[model samples]
Target: MISHRAPDSLSTWRAAILIAVIALLVSCGKPPPKEISTLDKIRTTGVITLGIRETSVPFSYLDDAQQQAGYAWEIANRVATAVKRDLKLDTLAIHTFVVTPQTRIPLVANQTVDLECSSTTHDRERERQVGFSSSFYLTGPRMLVRRDSPVRDWSDLRGKRAVVSSGTTAELALRKLDRERGLDIEIMLAKDIGENFMTVETGRAAASVQDDVILYSNIARARDPSAWQVVGAPLMREAYACMLRKGDVPFKRLVDATIAEMARSGELMQLYTKYFASSLAVKGGVRIDQPLSDDMRELLRQPNDRID
Candidate 1:
């Protein structure tokens, strides 16, 4: 065998060969990159996957039959209708998935669902992860306490246990109050809003703070609706909107436009009245009434998505 030395371009030739191999491997193993726009995905699949809450009460919840329906989901369905019209699809089927507070953000960020029709709040921090349509409902953080509980306001919260959902604006707001007011309030974490209220029900916590709208939902679902009282000054204003994937300006525009059209034509208010302002039958034939607040109508008058 003849002894051989590497050529001057040997390293460059190896790099080029490696690149070629990588390109070939990528071409073989990887499918074309998925289309980014949610609208595009809807167009391609002829279906829209909607993320609805499994236990969000009046916003979105699982019925006895495991079907999802609520004020928020009704709004989402209207938007889906607009989407179907926009795409001019002969038939666009809607698929549903359950998203809890923990999974909601990631599901939207990963585009697992085209839109999250759950009771999701629009805020600055969350805006970094996902997009929101125009405001659909407006609510504020409030505390729910036992009818006999002495906790009338935040001052009474001093040294008392308070329960809030693990990932919610109420949790953040309560924590902030504890820090600034030094109320020494014992913050108890619950898995979801229902459990947050249940902490008070089971006497594990003295108070459950969440959106007033949801508090009413819980009360309506409670075994004894009159046993719990939602009281206290509002903690923070929250705007609930349908969560979408971020950076899709076109889709965002369409969603916002759909909401605006609904507002302009007063159809959103009509749905709100139909669903919330009257006693509607929920799961198990439970009749719950959550009347729309004046602030909710004000939110409709001028839809806003800003967190502050």
Candidate 2:
């Protein structure tokens, strides 16, 4: 005959304590999960986040389908492929986050976006906050005005309301010019390229100061392309490159390698022609019609991260 009884409270508590101790011992025996680097995080999660622009036409923007599509968008995809290959990923998911000029750097700095390939300029000031891949495009600030507008150059902007995208190099350049030349220009700040152009279109501002390529692309996509024109010599040349988190050497190496490969194989030129020289299939067959420049050819020949 066998008799069964519940264990005493003290005995049961002891048993629970023993189990807790065993768990602690086992946990201590194993090393803590390795800290996740950007690459490692992407590898483990199978997703890479890309920072893109919504209205930076010909560089990064939305198509008629509202999907991200542009020259920089294509290059970002190539880098994604390289990341996938490097990680030996069977399938890597791409997640895009729309970024404005004001938020692009902060998002990248925080690693919320793994790569930003848009119209961002690479300069010493920005370099302190993020790492830039090889320079992919060269452009400079110019004025966009109505075809009949008298603003033929920067000097004409005096005492006029000129608009620029907030948090862009163009803004800084314009402000500096306003001060040095004493143009007394009333500068209006817009959130993005589209808004900047709209300020001029609506007659709220006399001119929109932006990168020359962007101005050209905007005119091409305008309702009446002939109504707008890009004027004035380029303010100062700027280089556009892919942005990653600061100190992300491995990822930067991969991005730089992919861009360099594209340059050497003439793929970059082909992409340039597709976006700048040819009429886009979207947005009613808009064509930028801007030809490649000597600086761009040189950059293609020797891809680099030189800041201007």
Candidate 3:
């Protein structure tokens, strides 16, 4: 039997205050939810984004069918597969975003894109904004000129008009050389590799300065391959590596391990042969026709992320 009493108002108010204080203590004792990381976000969403170049040829490009097809494109897919396996996802979706030289860094830095494995050169300056995976390929700036042109080397470009893709290491190197040697070269900037090549093809510029491999690829796809020539030795060797967001230790480790595994297992060499040796399936079966260089072979033998 319960007793009903309206005479204990003071005691009832004290009991209510005590209950409120206990509730507050319990709420304060529990920990907050953990903040999500890049991998965590990817695991939750089951999607990975890849940044690709549309006209970088064997590195990353759109094929005749408009599908992303290239050596780096294949490597990016492999990394995506690793992510799915690491996250234990039943199915992981791949989303591609086209990135130019100008936009790739910002996209990765701001987390708009997960990673980029194209014809990007990894250098100390870029390391300030983003991280890089193991070096996958190596090449340097060279000149692509008409077959009959008198320009045989960088020295020959003095007082001539030259075209280079905007925001590329080639542009930076060319400008530095111009100032140092007083070449007085009229520099022309193009938005993409296609435009750079076209500028030279249309006689608007005497030469197109770019990576040696890219010049070879352009000639391979040309109507008359013999009409052009890649001249001069490499100006300065540059390493090509996959780019990711800065300070992402786990993701960087995963990417570095993936690249090292490919190098150790000779899969990277096979990929090299597939794109550089054999005829490609793009643009009606074009071939880059470039032999593997000693530097590239060394890079495969020992995968590293050293940038100079």
Candidate 4:
């Protein structure tokens, strides 16, 4: 995580230090809850705040005009529709904010965004600070490596340097594996997905580790797509879902119910086809059709926020 501070406010050094220490202790990495509910605030203001990712391809990403597009963005549109109807409003304006990997969780916790419609996974650790809607997609950890590299599987990358975005499932899994297996792999952290790929592509790291789908998206955008190959079995399972603030049961119920309705009505399949069935022509254009794996199909049968 990046931390910034005032260059030098040393005129009253002792007072400044005391205030900074107090502020840090009070915040404690989590934001305080707001009295007004997310839905209530939205209805009162006639606008829904959505947090998006400009680099999360086939999920939440920005197009040439900076308008949000992709699978997650489309799903968010449906949720917005549901919210408008629920609030008895003909139309509600959407206030979109671009967020990086490090900031999305805090943004949701701080109530800066009503819903984060990006490719955030529903993991138990993340559940502690924020709430999640029903699982929308499923993926697993994988690696992207140079085509000519000898690494082909977990065993092959025994002592290699791997890069993952900070605060991601990939990083968490890698750290755990490194400790448990005594692999002694050098783990490097990147600020976001884009840099995660760069760390590998530039040969500074041996592999770019992340969710399989995300790595595939990066490969499609790579300068030399043919130069990199996605290898190795999945390290761990991941359930992708939208993120919101915790303790908002009413808002969560509405979001989950809306997702369930979409799934039951086949509207979800339409969206799945729209983004994954055909060749995705986004900034990082690729012909990757990641259909519902058997596990994913079963997840649709029963949707919940629980990671397990």
Candidate 5:
């Protein structure tokens, strides 16, 4: 026969039992975080929601009637076609969601969009929140100014205000520039590129900072391309990639493969040629739509490459 424990000992033992029960309940109460399934979701949905910028022309933007059109849109269409094949569906609705750099990942996390085809940079901080595709286009950061603006370089922004896109790498670049040169310039953020250009055009802001390629593309697509100018030198080299939810390996792999296939087939080149080759009206000089540079060309060559 076992003897009974002292009162204090019994109390301690009882508390231990209570703690274990509480722990068990806590473990069982909450459900695990939802796992991201790359294949099944696409198969069942029969649609791919693509995140695109509404006004970033030559990459992803609206046409005259405000319908989606551009190089990035073309890429999205091809990816949608492949997804349709996987689902055995004849036609999949290519739903387009307008997103900014700041909102892109949050939308993906919430399943508001299947993939982001907008101009997005892959950074360690961003990777912690979402997965990134291989670099689709690589370029350097540059500035946009009116034809008669006084700003010659990034340093010229000191004691001046520069317009930047809200929640973009451009804004971050400007911040870094501010710190390095100890410039006291103020940075203003615009809701979109259209407004950003307007900031400089109206003389409200001295210049606009952006990716060199995007600034060039914008100038190429402008109504009167000669009215504005892309000024200054490249401040930083950037590699733009498509963004997806973190941990969705299969979907990322499939997209990488599709991009590679397009590159190999020369379809990517054709798409770029179709949309970005024409130069829009401008002021200072004729802004020729340059051919795909070496960095972008290399990006096109790497099919199925993943970003770690």
Candidate 6:
């Protein structure tokens, strides 16, 4: 049988072939990967996939018929309308995708959804991975406790455990507070807001830390409002925005512009009032004042500012 390797000449030939293969791979023109913008995708598909929360109460939740409707849902529908107009589509279909706190970012990044109008916390760390719309809502961290619980403020939880939703900005804010303030409070994470608040409900944890908006909305959903109380001073101010994939500059611009237009025309305030304000005050005794954050003012002036 002929020798598999023809001595040094065969070895040289194999080495050359390997180098050529690598060069071919390096120089391969594979369409430079498909980098489609949200706007482009909308135009191409004639559909907008909006990611919403499944159990976020007034933000985005299922009704009796299990259809999506809430403040976030309405806002997303408005944006979808603007998107359809921008793309000059005959009638762009709006698709709803339920997302939890943990899956929102991944869904946006993977293009499973075009825009995420869920109750997502806007932060610098998250901005690295996904784009955020102009801040339409400004909120802070708050604690929910039993009506009879002695914990009235943020400082009362020295040794007690504070429950928060897992993989959420509330948990991150609590951890940061723990390190910065040297607070010895044990931070516990629940799978969701309902679970986090359940800790307080069952008296298993001293308190539950979460977004003030979410807390108020959840309280409104509760069958017994007198059983639990949202306690303590605001721990941290966080902004909420519509999230999209990062590097979609065109998409980001369009989203920003849409928000600015809404703010300029006072439509955003109306949405907030219609969904969040009166409901909270009348039902939960929480009055969310207007122009809560600087973003509100800036958005009023320039609604399309790039938050990321």
* C-alpha TM-scores of all predictions: 0.83, 0.81, 0.83, 0.86, 0.75, 0.78
TM-score of model 2 (CA atoms): 0.81
Superposition-based RMSD of candidate 2 using all C-alpha atoms, in angstroms? 11.4
The best candidate by TM-score is 4
For model 5, the local distance difference test gives 0.75
lDDT of 4 at 17: 86
Cand. 3 Cα-lDDT: 0.89
Put down candidate 2 lDDT per residue, 1-308, tens digits, no spaces.
54466558679999999999999999689666343367887988899999988877788988888877899999999999999999999999999999987799999987799999998889988888888999999999999999999999999998999999887889999999999999999999999777888888999999999999988888887889899888898888899999998778788899999999999999999999888988776766788998677988899888999866
Cα-based RMSD of candidate 3: 14.0
Q: Write the residue-wise lDDT of candidate 1 on 73-163 in tens digits.
A: 8888888998999999999999988887778899888878889866788889888878888888888889989899999999999999999
Measured on C-alpha atoms, candidate 6 has an lDDT of 0.75
Please identify which of the two predictions, 3 or 4, would achieve the higher TM-score against the true structure. Answer: 4
Give the per-residue Cα lDDT of candidate 1 at 304: 66
lDDT of 3 by residue, 220-273 (tens): 988899999999888788999999988788988888888888888899899999
Residue range with the least summed lDDT across 10 consecutive positions in model 4: 283-292
lDDT pick, better of 2 and 6? 2
Model 6, residue 233: C-alpha shift (Å): 2.7
Q: Which ten residues in a row have the lowest lDDT in candidate 5?
A: 279-288
All candidates' lDDT scores?
Answer: 0.83, 0.89, 0.89, 0.82, 0.75, 0.75
